[model samples]
Target: MTSSDTYQGLAVTTPVSLMFGRFSDAATPLLYARTLKELLAQSGLQKDDVDGLAVSSFSLDPDPAIALSRSLGLSLRWFQDVNLGGASGGIALNRAARAVAAGDADIVACIAADNNLETGFQDLVRDFSVASRDGVYPYGAGGPTSVFALLTKQYMQETGATREDFAALCAGQRENAKTVPHAVFNEPLSPEEYLASRMIAEPLCLYDCVMPVSGAEAFLVMSEERAQALGLSYARVLSSIEAHNTHGDEASPLSGGWATGRDRLFANAGLGPDDIDIIQTYDDYPAVSILQLEELGFLPSGKGASQLATSTHWQQKHNTSGGQLSCGQAGAAGGYLGLVEAIRQLTGQAGAWQRANVRHALVSGYGMVVYDRCLATCATILAAQESL
Candidate 1:
């Protein structure tokens, strides 16, 4: 692979989140429309002002980006349909930044929304990809829980991580969720309670899985000068990187593409892990979070559990928004959750759980598990405008 590239004079602002409970009768288009409306209102822009759009969803079947644009009555100069699952947020932000930098569009909205119908999730996973439809689902390995179960098990065995390590991660996020009004599982989760939660798959318990809900998360991308003219709080994109299927032939993979791109990710940003004040990792599962931390150079590979257990580094610096574990994963919106929260914290919009003097934040995304391993991995670092 090549070295990473940096984003210049691009500002990410106007974060919006509309997360319904475990289920929402609202259609995917309606969710997107609502999110866009909020985004426009927050940015003080008209529908005509947004000249670009980027969207990600799993249930927008028979409806591509063009269809959504038509439905939303948007006349866009540019558009992107992102399908990177949990990695969509960073990818969308990266692509939208490039679009604005290249003068393709003046203002871009990056949004991800989805609905949780009774059977929608099942249908999504069963036919997610050729690997799942033809190879994995026919035998009864229907969803990601089982696949991640095996991954978590192998990670535990290899890294000497225990259920307690995962429990700490979940419980801490739950505590953080308490201050987040939109979090679905805000009740304080103790380690004892996490351990006692029923088992969904061997080594994967109930609390370890993300609750699928229907909702949308969105943010606006524009030039730094435009943001200043609008008098808006914003975060500057330092550097972003993405890699897919980096493991190649490793079927039961225990790692992700972050390892392949992390050095350049930090190097291009001119900041090391210690410089980051907060980190928002895609927490589809605790073990996956651990892997991301290790791969991102937060901790040594095999020492994840020990370092996490013994130190407050992760406890203080990680997932200040409670993550998908507590907030409920709204399909592709799970990808945008961390990004939105990072923008919030950086922009001084994060209410109670906001950290003081958060100069920089790191957000990572992992998603699209076809069968054994997640295929998409992406990360972006953002700095508060004042810090720049």
Candidate 2:
């Protein structure tokens, strides 16, 4: 079905980022608490003011939203525990926006945080799902590297994209990372350096894989009237769409649900790709980002590499926060990174990397790799209030 302006009168504000590191001694709960504290502080809201909370995390197993609410001392009228991995941020925004718009909650806080323990990543992936435990682990393919490697290989064969193409993407993001104070890998990366980087899986090198880090990202969703009464800087949610298990039958999937909902996404937003001033994609890997760029109508299918050279340029219009590629994937926080960055840009909070007159922004998410391919894909368009 097509969509209309379902997200009218919503204000997404108070983007907060915290505790980015290769490892954090703190537990997942502490990370979540710290993030929540900052989210409230930045929004000038008391703890009790937030009656709605949505959380996403891979390490917060056993302790779900109910347990977290008790720990945070929150008596909420609305709550959600998102499990969509990299797509959690957009999904959280989608749900929380509707909640506030429908008066189910006055102000909803969307938060994703994770701790980067010594063996956190490996442990999390070793038994990620039934497909991973049975189909993948038995054959020693315990993590996403092998799966992405296979997809990268197929994507290359189909699109005629080379390592140099992916290198351009990575190299450009490293440049973008320089402007982000919290980014982990801001070191300069040349295409040659990317090509020379050690190969982790066939066709997928060390540089192509995301570095697991500890971090949290959060934002508040409420009505425009509420945001104005608080005198807060906010962005209007123009449109958003999410889907899962698209192209599930393909032996080697190259795309996801983004394409199926692309037309409706733009139509609902009342804008096209050309109207976007900034783009933040879930860059767990360059190739994955490329596919999103293609499927979302930024570039044509099998032609993503062509845009990498220009899109990844310093201070250019793509993955402006350096993405999870250079920013370091902070568990489920990787999903929220783009959303936070987009909100920051729209609110004039992005310091060095802020683009001029960033009236429109696009954020896309892809994640939940089960066995063969990732199942979830989501995208959202946000507009500066003045642009409305």
Report the lDDT tens digits of candidate 1 across residue range 1-388: 2222436788999989888778877889999899999998899988999999999998888777579998899999999988888899999999999899889999999999999998878878888889888877787653888888888999988878999988888888888889898899899999899899999987999999998899889999999999999988999998899999999687669879898989888988889998999999999888888888899998898778767766565776788879999899875849999999999999999999888899999999998988778889999999999986
Cα lDDT, all candidates: 0.88, 0.86
Q: Where does candidate 1 stray beyond 4 Å?
A: 1-6, 331-333
lDDT of 1 at 177: 85
Task: List residue ranges in candidate 2 displaced over 4 A.
Answer: 1-4, 310-315, 331-333
Candidate 1's TM-score reads 0.97
- Expressed as tens digits, the lDDT of each residue in 159-254 for candidate 2 is 899888888888888888887988988889998998988998879899999988999989999999989999999999988999999788876688
